[model samples]
Target: MFLLSFPSLIPLLRAGLDLDCAESWIEEKGRPLRDFLSEYSKAAVEQGKLRESDIDNALRNQYMTLMRLGYFDNIPRYASLNETDICTDEHRSLAHDGARQGIVLLKNDGNLLPLDPEKILAVAVHGPHARAPEKVMDGDYTGPPCRYVTPRQGISKHVKISHRANTTIYLGGINLHIEREGNDREDLLLPKNQTEEILHFAKASQNPIILVILSGGGIDVSFAHKHPKIGAILWAGYPGGEGGNAIADVIFGRYNPGGRLPLTWFKNKYIQQIPMTSMEFRPVPEKGYPGRTYKFYDGPEVLYPFGYGLSYTKFHYETSTDGTSVTLPATGGHCKGLSYKPSVATTPSCQAVDVAGHACTETVSFNISVINGGGRGGAHVVLVYTAPPPEVAQAPIKQVAAFRRVFVPATSTATVPFTLNVCKAFGIVERTAYTVVPSGVSKVLVENGDSSSSVSFPVKIDFSV
Candidate 1:
C-alpha cells in the first residue's frame, strides 16, 4: 500500500516519523539511505526521542507485510508479472465492472437515455477525451494499459439512444492538470472555452444532447442540468482502461448505470466564495461560511447533492422501523443512576463504548424494501443518514450512519436490513474526545435512487453516568 515516492527524508520525515522503508538513493544521491538513517536513528534514541524497540517493531511490521506479499519468496509475484500476466481477460473484466459501478447517471430528464440501436442511425461526438484515454482514463499512478476504449470508439458501435431526434455527445471534464497530489483546483467550473463550446453546439442543435464529465472531483454543471437541449448527463469519473466499453454499455442499455455520485456537485461560485485551504466542516451562517460535505455544508444549492444519481428504472423504498428508540446499557463504575443500571461507556462521561458490551447490542433496525418497478434488473445503493438534534453543536446536519447495496430482480423487491448502535451512531465530537448526547427528536433518513423515506426516533443513552 505504501510507495516510496521520495528519496530524501528532510521533506516528509520529522522527529517522530520513523522511516521503515526507503527507495535506493545511492544511484541518485551518491549515498546509501541506511547511512543517513543509522546516524539519525542513533541520535534519536540517545535523545530519548525514539526507542530501539520501536524501531525494531516498525521494521518487523514492514518486513512481515512484505513477506506476506511474497516479497522474499524465490519467485516473487513481480518476477512472474509478464505482459500476459498483467492485463488478462479477468483483469479487463474487473476493470470494466469497476468502471460500470463508478459511472454515475447524473441526469436523465424525459428518460432520454438507454439509446436503442434500432431507433437511431448516427451521432456527433465532440471534445478531446472522446478520441483517446490520454488523461481522463488515468489518474495519480498508472501503467500502460493493454487496451484503451475511448468514448468515441465505445458509442460508435451502438448509436441509437432515443427517438427524440438528433443527438450530440460532448465529453468535457478535466484531467490531473486540475487537481492532484500537490495541486489544488482554482475553480469548479469547466474551462470557459469548454462551456462556450457546449453552449454553442447546444444553441444550434435541437432538443436532446448528452454531456459526459470525466473527472474525479465535483464540477459545476448547472448549465447542462437546466439546459433544454441537454437531455442527459453522466459523471464517468476517471474510468479506467475499460472505461469506453462500460460507458457504451450503459448508453446502449446493455448495462444500467446504478452508480451514485460519491460527492456533491457545487456551483462554480461556491469554490470562489470558499478558500481552497479552508478545513472547517460545520457551517457558520453569521460568518457567511457554508459548510462542506453532505453532512455539514449549508452553502448555496449544490448542482447535485451527494448520493445523487438517476437510474434507468424507478425503485420504490419502504421502511419498517423496528422501534422509535433503543435503550443503552449501563456498565462498569460509571453506571450510577442510568436507565439500565449498567454503562454503555467503558470510560467516564461516556467518551467511548465497547460495542460488544451488553448495553451496545440492541440497536435501532430498519428493514428497507427496494422494489424495481422497471423491467430491467440492476443494483441499488441504500444510504442511511442520521440527524442529531439541532441543539448538538458539533453534530452534522445529517450523518451517513449506515448503508447497504441490494440487487432487486426486475419487478421484484429486495429487503436491506440496517442497524445502528445507540451509543456510537449518535455521538458528537469536540476536538479529541466524543460526548454522547441522545436526542428524542433525532431522525433517520433512508434513501435509494431518487426516493427517500424518513422516521423520527430517539436514541436513549445513559448519559447520567
Candidate 2:
C-alpha cells in the first residue's frame, strides 16, 4: 500500500523494495484537502495556537482521537496515528479527505457527466440533511471550527449563479444522525422530507437540474423513476469540509469523479433482509425481505448496487488467454492450514493444484484488456472469482481471487495479464476437511457485477500427484 504513495517512482524500485504506498498518499491524492490543511496550518501559526514544529505533534494527537471515534474500525488507514488532540486544519482535512474518496457516482448514461459550469445556467440545492447536524449547528465551534462546503456551496464554484435563479442543483438525503429509533436507520431510503425535496426541485427547476445527495447510506430515488428532465444524480455521501468544493469540481468537468459505492444503496431494503448470520437460513419475504444485494436480489431493481459508480468517460474490457495454470507462494505453514490459496490451484481450464506443503505451480493467468471507449479517461477493475464444484457438501458458491485496476486514456487500450494462485481463491473452513480433491475441474471467471457476463476457463486438478 505504501508503494502507491509515490506513484511516479520507477516500477523496478517498487518491485525490488517491496515498497507500499505511504499513508501520505491520502494527503497526496486529496489536493483540495491538502491545500486546506496548508492554509489552516498557516492560520494557526499566525493565531499563536501552534508553531512550525507543532504540525506533526498535532497530527499525532488527532490520530489518537480518530482511533477512539470507532470510525477507524471501518477505516483502517487512519489507524496508524498516535496523537490525541488535533489542529482544526488537520481534523477538517481528515474528514474531507476521507469523505471525498467515499463519494460514489451511481449512473452516467453514455458518460453525460463532468458537466460544464460555464454552460450551465442554474443549480438548486436542497435537503433536510444538507446543512450541518443539529449538534454541530447548536454547539460552540471554538476550535478552528467545522468549516464545510455544502453541495450548494461547492456547486457554486463552477456554475455561473443561481439560488432561486435559472438552473438548479438538488442536494439532500437521509439524515443518518437523526434517530427514528434507539438504533439509527436500518432501512436505507431517503428520509420522507428529503425525497420530497428531490421531487420538488425536479419540478421547480427551469433549466436542467442536477440532483446530488449527501448521505452516509443509500436511498430510494425511484421517485425519479424514469423522470426525463432530471439530468444527473450524485451520491455525495458525508463529504467533509472540502466535499462541497470537490463535488463542484466533479460536476463541472474539472475532475473526472471516478468513484463507486462501497456498500449497497437499496431501492427498499435493510440488513435484516440479507443473510449474514446464518448460511442455512431460508429466504423469507413476508417479513419484508426483498433479497439482499446482487447476490440473491434479482435484476432490474436497485437504485444502485455495490460497485456501482460512473465516470465522465466510458470503458470496455477484453480478454486474451482463457486458460490458466496456478502457482503457490511461500507462506507460513500455519496460515496454509487456515486459508487456501486457490490461485496456486485453480486454472481457467478447470484444473486444481495442491497448495499445502511448499511453493507449487498451478499458475492461472488471464490476459485482460481495457479501453477508454468513451469521451475521456476512466478506470476499470477486473474482478476474478472461483466457482465451487457442481457438488460440495458445504462450500461457498464462489470466491473472489484476483482484481486489477487500470487507467485507460480516451480512444486507447491497455492490456495486462492477471495471475491468481491458491491463497487468493479460498477462505478457511474451520475444523473442516483440509484435503484437496483432484478429479473435478474448478471454474474460474472474470466479471464486474456478481452476475455480470464473464468469460470462464476450465482446469484439470492433480491433488494425488
lDDT of 1 at 316: 80
lDDT score of model 1? 0.71
Against the correct fold, how does model 1 do in TM-score? 0.80
Best by lDDT: 1
> Model 1 residue 353 lDDT?
36
Q: Which one is best on TM-score? A: 1
How well is each residue in 1-465 modelled by candidate 2, as lDDT tens digits?
322322222332323332222222234345523233443446656776555555655566667777788765866556655434443567766766555555566655444566666565655555554454433222122233265576556666666454776656666665435522222565656667767666677787675566777655567776664676566777776565567766776777665665666666665644545544444222344554444444345334566666666666666556766654433333343222223334455333323333354354456666867667677776666666676454432344455667776667788998868766554453323224553333345677665433334577765433332
Native-referenced Cα lDDT, model 2: 0.55
Q: Work out the TM-score per prediction.
A: 0.80, 0.62
Candidate 2 stretches greater than 4 Å from native: 1-101, 109-112, 132-147, 178-182, 269-301, 325-363, 393-397, 426-439, 448-455, 459-461
200 Cα displacement, candidate 1 (Å): 1.6
Deviating ranges (above 4 Å) for candidate 1: 1-16, 19-65, 76-78, 160-165, 333-359, 435-441, 451-465
